[model samples]
Target: MATLKVLGAGPVKRGITQIAAEFAKASGHQVNVEFTGAPTVRERVFAGEVVDVAVVPAATMDEFAAAGCIAPATRAKLGHARMGLAMRKGAVAPDLSSTEAFRRAVEKADAVVANLANSGNYVAKLVGDLGFAADKVQRQPDAVKVMEQVASSPQQLLGAGQLPEIRELIDKGVAVELAGPLPDALQSVTAYDAAVAAASANAAAAAEFTAWLATPAARTAMAATGID
Candidate 1:
């Protein structure tokens, strides 16, 4: 067994990292996981930084693989992400029982931070479907950054651009409850996947890590990280 490394966008990183830890400990492998933006991973890989694996939105990897930077056959779909809403700690959860309340909360907030990645894109489309003006939304590239924004302000409201991040904020007392169900008009149900870098010298170890991540034991550990 060899050390397994992973680099990906923020939302799934936490839960997946936890799951990876358990898999490594039980499988007798060392694990080093790095969380980053979608574009950054490709940049680093092209720059020759060594990495065993990369996990990113399924859609984003097609171009890289097609260009021969990533091993296409080594890719495996992980799962999907759902969007939700949040507020800072101690702020009462908003009543998102209806579209009216949800929209009103967004409009009334001091600032509303949305993601620009998978979760954020879904949220942006959601805002449009809900009939909110473009000026009403503030877009950020990462969900963790959004969480940081809302959590830093007790009065600020935050929207979960993705399921994993929304669950994480609530669990960590960063925000209040998530908003209503992420409708398709605004939801992308982001497809996540693990792919080996073409330059990876540790393909066998990387493949093993991905396999363990898909196992029941991995799911069990993920549950503790607000993965559902």
Candidate 2:
């Protein structure tokens, strides 16, 4: 019964947490995961923070493979997380049926809240391209905080984050509700990957856990959390 230490990206926290429990039950291995922003995950791994596994955006996993921090052969694509919008629970759902409607909704909202992560950066640029004032987008440290800010706001602020993050907050009844995904043209999908650390003490168990991420049951669990 070896314990595996994992560093995972925040956007996939809900799905990964669920799957880690399932994996632990089936394999009798204890999986401990620390979740944070994708950039921080890369930074820590590059700084030689030792862990049995690392789960992050696919591109960052590529970087880790190149840096020899993760075993190339153990890397597996997890799933794609799409950008989505959320509002305070009971707030009127905004019209996101088309690009123009999305723009109008953004224009009318008191503010657009987003985290300082990959999905938030994309949304910031998106609103900028739409001619919305940059000041209208409020940036927070992470998705959880973004949802919290929107949920607590008395104004009609829209929260932007990875779909899974938003869905998790809503499922937890965090006083926020999904307003659907971003418009097709304005959508951004981030693919995630998981890999065993090359220097892991429990390499075999870590490899087994990473491999399980691609299983059909795991995929279904991820999809239920909006990680499809």
Candidate 3:
């Protein structure tokens, strides 16, 4: 009953699409959820790509709305997300139950991959939150590159994963056991939101889908996909 063109950043993209598919099945409509990092999503939107709704990071969403890409008033603050650290499955998962342990893990780690835009901000915030601001390790801006590097490297660190994505990434050659888990304070959530594009062709449908995202059914789907 609906068709939504949405944009999302990494970290929770796999979960995002899984939930979107479920929503589509329930809504009796086709939902096309595009997955990309915050930077690429911004690039696409800013470059004038056509889309109906978006579920990017809260900060990026606000900027897009302010820039007239998304309807300012149509914006709704979604919930938060957790950025994690993943290693090779056979290796040791980092001890990140605390700030100190997280720092140790990152310091002792080999390679670190993170999104340069939204995920990067969250990971950076997490770094600062974990008192590792001085570490000065830069996470990559692209998710594919991050995934590739981690898979090839025996010891790699990933900075995203809300659950099923983590599981999927692990299956896709992510260094699960070799890398580690997300940090403690780094466990901060990124508030996701929905908004209609000002130039959308189906504003009503977009609004309906956005509203659906906040429903219990949607939340149930999101939770099932590892979104908070």
Candidate 4:
């Protein structure tokens, strides 16, 4: 078996990294996993980086395969993530139970922190739909960064992103508490998938590891990291 270089995006970061570690331990194979923005991951793969396996949005897995960046037959479904809201611990968790309530909370917040990638893009679109000025939304590099900003900032804020990312913050005691999932009507689910890179020197190992992501132990690992 050869060393596996795994490229992953924001939403799948925590879970996939842990699962990869478990795979490495069991298989005695070294797996180097890098977590970054979805766009960045796509760019890297397109740029011909050493990506043996890619864990990204399902749609991206398809696009990459179509573009000949990854092996066409190597795709495997991972899990889904839902956008949600978070607030610093002890702050009033705003009412996001309904669309109207959620809208008002976003409007009233001193700052609404959101990621600049998937969840962030979704939020930016929502902000436009609500007719709010773009300046009202503060975009961070990723969900964890949003939590970091909200935890350290003095202003009252509401952070919105994938529930798993928010949970990652709470798990690390980042002074943030989940408000809850977005209003059911507005909730957006992003499913993730993994595939072996077409250029991988160790395609066999990569394919085997990609398949392992669907195993029971992998699900447990994903669940442990707040990914379902």
Candidate 5:
């Protein structure tokens, strides 16, 4: 049996963790995953961090392959997740039925909380394009922290991040609930990809895990956590 270390983006944490457990059970391999923002994943890989597998945004994975951090041929698409909103549990959910409604919701929010990840960056730009002031947005380090701020705040806040991440925190009793995904016209879906690291000592086991991520069972697990 071999142990495979996986470094993944925060948005895919729940789905990847579920798939990792299933793979570990069937293959008798110990799979450990560290979840953080995509930028942090790239930074770690570039800094020479030794990892067996890496899962991040598809574009970032391509960058890794080009930089010789991960094997290009081993790359596989995981899935995509849509950006969504969350609010403290029991709070009146915002009207995200349409783009205009979304604009009104943001305009009425006491504060807009978002992570400093890809999803957050997109939402920040969308809000700006809608003519909202940048100062109204409070950016956190990651999704977990973004939810933490929303859950702890007494003021009415709109938390923005990947739906899977928002759902994960809500399921963990984080005092938050999904406010619904951004209105269709204003939605953003981020695609994710996984690959075995070029410097991995457990490349074979890592490859097995990455390949299994596209299997039927893995897709089921991913969908259960909001990953499309």
Candidate 6:
């Protein structure tokens, strides 16, 4: 059986994992998928890991293509991830209908928690732009840890991460409630893509798997996982 190594970010992780399982069963290939922060994904690529396919932010795909790590022509966008907020369970969910309201909410919160990658970076800048001290933000290395901090905190902390991840945490009873997406004006969306590695000996198999990721069945799985 052909084995494909895949690396990617958190937003599409659940969907991608499910897709990989189905792909393996149908195509008779083994897929080893790893999901991490976007920056780490880039680091893995730059370090020359034997990755057959990479599913990361679209912008990262450009970087990988420029570095000749992946075939530019094979890039296929999977989906977009929107930034969102999560508040402790039993806490009042704030109105985030506008950028002004979001700013105000952040100002009133006792503390704000966010992962230092992806959506968290955007939240950091938004906090700074809103006149909050950048250093005041609790920056964690990963979304799961960020939510863990928020869930265990007694203070009113607002945690931020990619919407899909936050939703997953809520489903898993992380003591957080979905406070909705960031206001449209300050909203950040990341489009994820999958591309075959340029150095892959399994290019044909990798290409087929990546192509299958864009099919209707895959989309259905993505939607079910809150990726879309």
Runs of candidate 6 with Cα error greater than 4 angstroms are none
For candidate 1, the lDDT comes to: 0.70
Taken over the whole model, the C-alpha lDDT of each candidate is 0.70, 0.89, 0.66, 0.85, 0.89, 0.88
- Structural RMSD, model 3: 3.3
Per-residue lDDT of candidate 4, residues 64-181 (tens digit): 9788888878788887888998887889888888999988998888878888787788888897798888888999887778998888888988888898888876887899888889
RMSD of 5: 1.0
- Each model's TM-score? 0.81, 0.95, 0.79, 0.95, 0.97, 0.96
Q: In candidate 5, what residue range of length 10 has the lowest lDDT sum?
A: 10-19
* Error of model 2, residue 3, in angstroms: 0.7
Off by over 4 Å in 1: 46-48, 98-101, 128-131, 154-156, 173-180, 183-185, 223-228
Which residue pairs come into collision in candidate 4?
A: none
Clashing residue pairs found in predicted model 1: 85-179, 115-120, 119-161
Q: Write candidate 2's Cα lDDT for 1-228 as tens digits.
A: 889999999567888899999999999999998998887888889998889999998888889988899998988788898888999889889999899999999998999999887878889999999998889899998888899999898888999988878877777879999998999988898999999998899999999998999899998988887777
Worst 10 residues of 6 by lDDT: 116-125
lDDT of 6 by residue, 1-228 (tens): 689999888789989999999999999999999998988999988998878999988888899999999987778778888888999888899989998899888988987898867678788888998899976588998989999998899988999888889988888889888887889898898888999999888998999889999899998899887777
Model 3 score (lDDT): 0.66
Residues 139-198, model 5: lDDT tens digits: 999998999899999999989998888888888889998899899999898899999999
lDDT tens digits, residue span 1-228, model 1: 787777776567876777777778787878888987776776776677778888887777776677776777778666666566766666766665566776776767765678666566656666677777775677766776777777775556655666677777677766456655544443456667778777777888777777777777666565555454
Model 3, 135-169: lDDT tens per residue?
A: 54456656555555665665555444444456566
Best candidate according to TM-score: 5
Model 4: lDDT equals 0.85
**TM-score order of candidates, best first?**
5, 6, 2, 4, 1, 3
Cα displacement (angstroms), candidate 4, residue 44, comes to: 1.1
**Model 2 — which ten-residue stretch has the worst lDDT?**
164-173
